[model samples]
Target: MDRHDELAARFEARRGRLRAIAHRMLGSARDADDAVQEAWLRLSRAGGAGIGNLTAWLTTVVSRVCLDMLRARTAHPEEPYGDDLPERAAGAGPEEEAVLADSVGLALLVVLETPSPAERVAVVLHDLFGVPFDRVAAITDRSLPAAKKLASRARHKVRGTPAVPAAEQDRHREVVEAFLAAARGGDLDALLGLLAEDVVRRADPATLPPGVAAELRGARAVAEGTVLLRERARFAAPALVDGRVGLVVAPRGQLRYVLRVTVEGDRVTAYEVVAGPARLRGLKLAVLDVPAADWAPDAPEGSPSSW
Candidate 1:
């Protein structure tokens, strides 16, 4: 085979391994693919003859690509893509690592998200992937001991104790349930008690009534507005939105909007009512449990299932 084709073959041979690494570094399978492709582009441009270890060279390239992506992500929080959502995946991609990581449940993933990019790299590489701290330090541009410290701190955040992941998910679930109950009952005090004083609620323009503001700030405003939606909550059901506890509002089993939330400690810091068709379709949504009343009997010809 010609030189280009030979290098391509070598890359394909390591595709799965590279994908697994990228997935751990970047939580999204789609983003992992992007990082992998970027690695290939650079490899094609640079060639492989000069590299002594293709696998290690590619790993470092992909890791650096992922690090840049993470840094950019922090600079520009993913804009709610009501307008710019990427095309849908043609089929399942390299989601197994992402799924298995999630299978430990979202508490771990949420905790992982709190770590800085360098800390995430150190923790995921050294702790999860069994990489040596020296290499991890090379990837993160830290001293070996500094890289070890990053992983140590992240480990504490993720698992104050080994049992924390499971316990934290349960606590988060309860908080969601309580918030829903309060919203449903139009209990102002209960709603206030659940929201952080700095809680912010943002709604997609498509979800708002004409002229209603898209963003609402402060716990009091959020609570008051939530209580006003008591009637709407009648059609809401608990679900997991983007691997986190959230709610979907389906009137007669047809999804009208989704409430995606960000919780810190016991209170909600931010939430968005995503109703635009494009944005809703892009979310990784799943019904948490089959609520009997999710699709009211005798009420619909188009219910979304037992969710």
Candidate 2:
């Protein structure tokens, strides 16, 4: 192949990895593609003669581009780029389904949106992608210690403390996951099976349909209520709501509701859906302790599995 063909071939080899970094950092597929294209443009201009490590150089360029996009997004929230995952899934063709299957979970993406641009770079580079702290520092233009601190802060925000012990938390997570699945599928019998006889569901006035009661009691009432929201439940995912196994309804990585659940003996006893902006701001958000392999780039595509 000619020199230009060789260069294009090499760039294509690393494009997926570069796009992954941008996607995690920006949480918008379109923005991720734009960042990757910008990196390619710069790489073509600079050529590979002076670069000792092409992968590292390309990563740095894409990261910098993503950081700029994030800052601009924060400054201009009016022009949001993240499309609602539920809406996309609803209308998704096979190719789109495969892409969604390969992407990070919506809940994790929502948690990532909380960090600053610098901190996000640190977390995405060091924590998620396993880049060394020194490389992360260079990417964020900070000292080693500063970069570590940023990663530390972002890590805490993304992985908040669980209220229960590890074993207990795992048990509750399974129950909550099942509950979410049942709710999403609109399986009233399954929902009733997971809920306690005296189960109570309290929701913010804003979350309920007009004239619907804010609080629902009894397994039958709560189960039916949950089934009614099967459409909204498409965006719900298991997450750490103030250090417990609960759920969050985030459409397109934007937090809308936090469900504080009380699980007892494999059944949901009660849950409160907090939707007010003030309440959501006060509650800490975190991703569940799912295996990192689930989000790996090589994970099976077209698997529309739950998060």
Candidate 3:
């Protein structure tokens, strides 16, 4: 084969790995593709001349690209999540894209957005991808010790201890999961069954329909109100909101709303739909039950059931 073809084939082999790294770092599929494409362009220009380790070289290139993109995002704090850029998978078809999007888990994406760009890069590289700390330092332009500390602080923030006891959290998670399922399916009966007689649902004004009130009371009203937004339920997923079981609406990896729910016994007594960006930033988000090891690229083959 031609030299160009040969290089393309080799890069394609590692594209999936590189794409995973960028996607997790940027928390957006389209941005990940942009980052990976940039890496390929740089490699093509350099022509693999002096790189002894193509894999490491490409990883550094992609990661540096992601770090720059993340820093740009942080600088523009008012950047809206509803950008016009269409979400795209690296090369996956529609079905594959859906699976890829779902597997990443909205919970992790929410938490990943919390850390500073440098800390995000440090932790994602060392902890998730198992890149050595020395290499992480090089990619992030930090001292070795500084790189390690960045990862440590980022990890702590990402996996803060759940506020509820293990048993209680599990119980709450079960109820919340069921509620999401019911809402997604538009099963009014099931939603009513899980809600208390006097259940209340308060939502941000930006989240409601034109005529719908900001606050809904009574189980019938709350359950009916929830079904009205079942379309959004398609993108909703169970997550830990402020150390408790809740839901996050992240359509195509962009977080839009969070459901802060309160459970009394087996029923959902109250829930507040938070859609304001300021409120979302204040939330302490963490992955529910699922550990980082499950989705980390360095995880053992069979252990990556989610990724």
Candidate 4:
């Protein structure tokens, strides 16, 4: 095969890994696809010229493309989040399923989004992909030490808000399930019992189109806020968010809320309800029916899950 054909084959071999990296960096499958396409274009134009590691070179190209896109996106924000998982047959291979599961996990992606582009690139390279700091620095266009520092900072930020113990996370799910049941049943007392005194709930202000209440604070305020959605909002499914139990609620088919229940000891300390399609889109959740069986809590930890 010609050098160009050889290069194309090499690029194809790394497609799955490249897509995963880009998806984690860009937080959108569509954007990741675009970035990868752009990377391929760059590679094709370069021909057989001077690239040492094809995978590393392609990764850098995709990273740069994604960074530019992210910067532009900040100037013109789009819908915040949505499902980006590619549909697959039920008989897909275990490796494909694992990749799909990790790629679409809302909590990990959300945490990655908190960092700057450089920090994200550094962390994903060094931590996730096992790239050394010197290599990461070259890819991210930073000095070796600077790249290490960026990765360190990203690690600190993420580890500081580590996922709650699996057991606590499971208990949180139970609390949320109970609350949802009570809400659907219109049992105000049971619903209130599940909430903390200083609970805070916020809807995506962008969705309201001006002059609408965006934030609701305090237990009483939060309880009253639910009243507005009493008949409209419906719970579709539940997931373990950042090692915490959480539920997805849709109002009028727009995916209005992601309710993350916070627990401290035996009592619920906070119920953070993130609503509105704009914000809910950040969580790429698979819409599934919530099972009735009680999911056993994973092992307990001292800290709660970061919502």
Candidate 5:
């Protein structure tokens, strides 16, 4: 790769961290993605200036971007903070099955909305992501003391909020992966077992494959339809869909569909698939580099047994 490619790769490397920062800062994945994209555009416009501390520079740029968004969001009360995991998935694009990852919980994110825009930026950057308070001050356009105070107040609220534990998040991932493995093997019983008795499958009109139901209810009905998901199932991999563990179907590097599901105990209660162009484009759907322990690696394209 040449200079441009190198810079892009480096930027991509920071995409998740930047998105995580933006997610907490803005409290909306859609808005968070918008902030990250805006930062990239600004970076590209600069023509790769020879700046030391690229990560810090990019972080500052994105923080400013999110700060502006939070201000706009405040001005327009119509755009509320985040929703539950399922609602977030329904509204979220085909990015990660678990869109939020382990960054912060939806409850805490809702609490973040209580903070002022500058306070949210300062707290998320300095406290959560560990940026120094001085740089946070620069990003928030506040004096050092003012910045510290903003973060201090936000931190107080955060301390009182409850967060989902890492272990529970891992359990969520396990159920999602089990569903994927069962789907891949066409294991009807396994599929039924993992699905709730009154499970529901909702899909965008364009996402339904031929003979597939636009909406399905009950485990048996959903499982019967799911075994037919063989073609896409083989390409499916675990992702952080709207901050909860979910699955995405991407044969190579392109996103075909995103399955955002709700899990209760070991059973999936509800889920939606987003595949329409307009919907997909709005999501954060880059190929996730999930570790091997997460799922069996995708086989080579066109190879036997690979989608």
Candidate 6:
């Protein structure tokens, strides 16, 4: 094969890993897909010559693209989930480490969303990918110590007790499953039993329309919101959200409304529901149809099982 063909082969091999990283970093699968495509375009033009680490190079490219997108995203606003909103992956194969670093769970991704572009690059590279400060410095165009500090700051902001243990996560899963069953069956009390006394359900402010930014607090409000959603929106399959049980809701005749549920102890404590055409693109979900059974609690990890 010619050098171009050879280079194309190499780039294709790394697409999955690169896309996974971009998805984690961008928080939108569609954006990640775009970033990966852009990275390949760059690689094709440059040719695959004299590259010390092809994986790292592609990761850097993808990160840069995502960073640019994030910069532009700041200008536009998002929407809130409908009043009827439901409360709702790993490994790079070698050369895959750079992209696989921090792309694990929803909690980590949400935490990552709070940092500036530079801080995200720093923390994700050093803390998650094990990349040295010097290399992170290069990628972020900052001094080594400055890069270290940025990562430190980001880490501090997101620091918390260790995540709920895996076994505990399983238990949470059971509770969430029961809650879903009850909600789908229109059992109000059964659904409320799965929520904490102080449960809070807030729509994604970025996606909600004006005059629709609503926050449902307390178990009663949450339970009420659940009923509203069940009566209105349809759901795609259930996907494991942040390593816990969760599902995605796509409203009838609407292209958005992705809900992710966070279960604490035996009750639901947090609900993150996002709605917007752009954000929904990355979710790879149907426009108005409820997701398939594949999105249920037992679906494979990282599947578009839930929002």
lDDT of 5 by residue, 1-307 (tens): 8887888897887787777777666655677788899989888888678767667888889989878877876787442111112222454333353333322423234445557889888876765566787888889999999999999887665443112465776787789888877876689999988999999998876555566668999999899888875545654666555556677654322346778879888789988887775665455422222343322112112111111
Give the per-residue lDDT digits (tens) of candidate 6, residues 86-199: 232133132232122212322344444456867766665555445567767877788988988988887765553324675785676577657766666567898778888888
Q: Mark the regions of model 1 whose C-alpha exceeds 4 Å error after superposition.
A: 79-88, 92-109, 160-307
lDDT of 1: 0.66
The lDDT values for all models are 0.66, 0.77, 0.79, 0.58, 0.66, 0.59
The ten-residue window of minimal lDDT in model 5 covers: 298-307
Write the residue-wise lDDT of candidate 3 on 43-90 in tens digits: 999888888777788889999999998788778754333212243435
Q: Which candidate model has the greater TM-score, 3 or 6? A: 3
Per-residue CA lDDT of model 1 for 163-223, tens digit only, reads 1265565667678778877886688999898899999999887555566678889999999
lDDT of 2 by residue, 162-198 (tens): 8989999999999998998788778999999999999
- Candidate 6 matches the true fold with a TM-score of 0.55
Count of clashing residue pairs in every prediction: 0, 0, 0, 7, 16, 18
Q: Candidate 3 lDDT (Cα, whole model)?
A: 0.79
TM-score of candidate 2 versus the correct structure, residues matched by position: 0.80
Candidate 6 positional error at 120, Å? 1.5
Off by over 4 Å in 5: 79-105, 161-307
State the TM-score for model 5.
Answer: 0.49
